[model samples]
Structures are given as structure tokens and as C-alpha cells.
Target: MLTLDDFTPVTLEDRAFFLDLYARYPQQHSDMSFVTMMCWNHYAHYAYARVGDGVVIMSVIEGEKTFRGPIGPRDPAALEEVLDLAVREGCAAPYYVFDEETLDWVKALYPGLAFRSDRDFADYVYLASDLDDLPGKKYLTIRGHLNRFRRSCEPVVEEMHAEDLAEVREFLKKWCAWRHCDESPVLAEEKEAVLYAMDHFSDLGLSGLMIRVNGAIAAISVYDDLNPDTALIHFEKGLPDCEGVYKAVNQEAARLLAPDRTYINRESDVGVPGLREAKLRYHPHHMAEVYVAEKTDLEKRHQGRGEI
Candidate 1:
């Protein structure tokens, strides 16, 4: 049986383990990538347990928890063991499949199970070329934003280096201080997560871009290859001094990532309306769908009815 003790925190060394698994089962979802797991471990508290020949991954925040994987290949007995243990341990939902491949596998494994889609967690995936070039009339507004910013201030895009990270750290402190990161639980966790990524940037096989206006860092974005064809942006932060620096940094990051990656995954909106609107403006080629699974036996039943 799988227990909490079996799960260990995701770290930089787990890259090889995940990479081998991912090569066998390629995925594009942001959360499935090792880079996302390691960087956001402070926020999500990701951990993994080896279950026979497969692996079981879990994420916890506050006291609530969710699970994914047994990622290698399907093992009916293994899934049954881990999930049953998870239910006994108070995981209301034991599975979150972030792509259609995993969803279909689950459906085939348990035809009677219920799978619920959550748009709030669906990752917005776009063509790297679209973001890099901002082509066509559809991108007119984005182009306008960049043009106005260019007219107002000169924007310089530089590849982030080890030497530049100290000032970048200071910039992040300034950014978080402005948002009062210490006062809000969510922001505080995110602040810590962002700093962790900065500290382990190279160890995680990551690259970043910094946008400077008038010789001051205005915005920064970090990204990593999620799979053979997809690149995922783990974090992007900007300051008020540069009005359109967000747009500028995003495009530049896409340009850097697009040379070898075909798709750019900007990750989930977390049901934030303003963020949803902003990401939608980029015109995602498709969404990396997410589904929550529940065993039929776990569904609530009324005294006189089959389901309630």
C-alpha cells in the first residue's frame, strides 16, 4: 500500500527519473513537467512515490490534496493499491489527468468511473510563432501595445546570466514588496516559489529573458522545455514603471523558445477572470484539458435514491 512516507519532495536530481518516464509517455501539460513541479514545490508541495514499476505523484496545498500518475505504463493492481490507500488517507479525489492520453487511459481502465473537466485548470497552449512574430490582424492590439511602449521607452532584451541574478533577486523583492507578498498566503507562497526557481535556474535546465527600459530591469520571464515539441513558461513578472513590458517580455521569451519548440504553454489561469482575458488575447491554438476522476463507490447516495 502507498503511504505518505513513500512520497518524497521533488528536487533537481529527479530530472533524470522524470525525463526517462516522460520520454516513454510524452506530455504537454504544465503541471506534468518536472520544471513546474520543482519550482512550484513551495506552493503546491509536490511529491512522488514509486509504486512498483510506475510512479504516483501528488500535490498538496493547505490541507487539501490531489494525485496524478502511476505514470510509466498502466498497472491495474498498482492503481488500485495507491488509489485505495489515497482514499483511506482522505484524498477526496485521487486522480487529476491533465491530457487526453491519460484521460483515455483512465476511461479504458475503468469504464464506469466519472471524469469531470475543469476549465479553470486547462493550460492555454499556443503556437510559438504566433507569440514570437505577433502576426496577422488578430495580433493588432498586441502589436499596438508593443509599438506604443517602444515609442515611450527603449526596450532591451537580454538573456539572463548567473551574474545578473543578484539584481534580479532584488527586483523580485521589490516586485513582491509592492504586492505585499508577505500579507497574503497565496502571494507569499508564490513569492517563495518564484525565488526558488531563480535560485535553481541552471540546475533545472532553464533559461530566462530580462527586459530593461532605461537600463533598469522592467520585466523577466522564465521557461523550460516541457516535451519534445512544447515549452512551458513557469513564471513571468513585470513592474509598473514599464507600461507594456509584460507584452514585450512575453514575445521575446517566445522568440527564444521557438527556435526548437513548436508550442508554448503559458499554463493555467486559475479561474482569475482578468488573467483569463489576458491569456485568451494571445489566441491559444488549443487547451491542455484537465480532468478529475472519482470512483463510483465514492459518489454520495441518498437514502431513497441511487445518486444524490
Candidate 2:
């Protein structure tokens, strides 16, 4: 039986092992690393789960909310036990963000569990190795953005530096200020974590693309490898005035990552109407569904309460 001790991120070797397992899990990808990096960057209680000699899981414990990823194992009984342990040790509701196949398996095992059922968040998109041969319809808007970005700003995409942290932090503060204008709960912890990610940004599978106009940082995007074949974007921000800055960053990223991988996992939108619209505009091939699993009816009720 997997014990609580199996959940700690003991060493780099252990971390790498989990990273590898998560990547190969068919459904879970490098996004787990992104989530884990966010937790570690913020010093939030994050760890890995050793389900067996070969299986490793990533988990994050944040106050009353616990997020789990890459549901690695295929055994329903084993996963059920792990879910129970995760919720207990995590001291929060356990959640798994994964593809539809894994979701189907878990739902079959735990018939009564509930999910917020959302598609509005950032979704994963894949690209062809040949950047020159861009696809039709789906990528029309993306191409347009890149074209417009060139007209509006002399865009410059580059790896992030320690010096960029100050600018990124300032950008976030401004962005958060705008977010707060809409009564969004601006979590200081999340900002702290993002800054932390910036500090070790490169080491954490991140490629920062900065767009400059007249030598000033106007837009920036941070993305990293979610798997050997997929990249996941974490945070991307641009000044509203900047015409094609966001698209410029994406095209440049496709160029940079062409040699390394073929897919991009932008992640979910948390059911926000506007965010969903923006993601859909990008035209994702398909969205992976994520769900929360629980053994007790009380925990299910708690999940609904949080949504309310």
C-alpha cells in the first residue's frame, strides 16, 4: 500500500522520475510540471506520489484547495485508494485535470463524483513541425495576429532574464489591478509564486518571449515543455494597446520550439465566459476534461459549495 511518505518530493532524482512518469502517462503531460513549478516557486506544499515502483503523481496542497495531476495509474482500485490518501493528506478537495479517457475511467470507478465541467480555460493546441506550412481556418486568426503584431510593434522575442523579473512583476501588478477592478480576489500568494517562477523560469521548462516596441517591454509570454512532444503556456500578458504582441510571441514560440516539440497545451479557462471565447478563437483541436473525485458525499457537497 502507498503510504503518506510516498507523497514527498524527496530529491531531484525523485522529482525527475515523477516528471518522466507524468509525461508518458498518455493523458498527463508537462502541465504537471508547470503546476508543480508554480507550487514550488511559491513554496506551496507540493510533492510527488510514488504509486508503485514505476508510477509517480504530482500534487499541490494550497490551504483548503488541493490540486492533483496526471492521474498516472490505470488501475481503478489503486487510483481510488490514492485519491482518498491525497484528499486526506492534502487537507483539501482533490482534483485531477486530465484528458477525457482518464476522466471516463475515474467516473466509472467513482460514479457519484462531480466536476465543475468547464471548457473556457486555455486548451492545448498542437502545431506541425514545418512552421512554413501553417494550417487553414483554425489558425487563420493566429496568423492574422502575427501579421498585425508586425505592423504595430517591432516585436522582439527572447528568453527571460533575471533582470526581466522586475518588469514582469510590475506588469503583473498592473494586470492584477485591472483584474481586481472586476472584484477578482487578487491572491498575493499566486503573484509571489509567479515571481518565483520567473526567478528559475528557464530551469522550469519555461521559454519567455518578450515583445518590445522602441526597446520597451510591451508584451511577454512564458511557456514550457509539458511533455517530450507538447509545450504548455503558463502566463501571457500584453498591453491592450499593443496590436499583435501576443500573436508575435506565439509565432516566435512555434519557431523556437519547432526543433524540440510539436504541440502546445494552453490549459483550461475555469469556465469564464470571456476567457472561453478567447480560447475558442484560437481553435483548439480538442479539450481535455478534468474532474474531482471523492469517496464521501460530504466532500462532493463541499465541491459544489466552492463553486457557488
What C-alpha lDDT do the candidate models reach, one value each?
0.84, 0.59
Per-residue CA lDDT of model 1 for 110-217, tens digit only, reads 566677888998999999999999999999999999999988988888999888889899999989988899999878988988898889888888889899888988
Clash-forming residue pairs, model 1: none
Top-scoring candidate (TM-score): 1
Q: Can you give the TM-score per candidate against the true fold? A: 0.92, 0.72
After superposition, candidate 2 runs with Cα above 4 Å error: 1-6, 9-14, 23-31, 34-44, 54-62, 65-77, 86-97, 104-122, 128-146, 161-184, 187-190, 294-308
Candidate 2 residues 1-308, lDDT tens each? 65667666534345455556666664443335644445343444555565543344554434543545435557655664566665565444456545667667656655656666544433556552433234777677677777776876666666677678788778777766655633534345555656666766655556676767777677776776666677677777777667767666666666767777766666677676776776666666556555554435425533533322
Pick the lDDT winner. Answer: 1
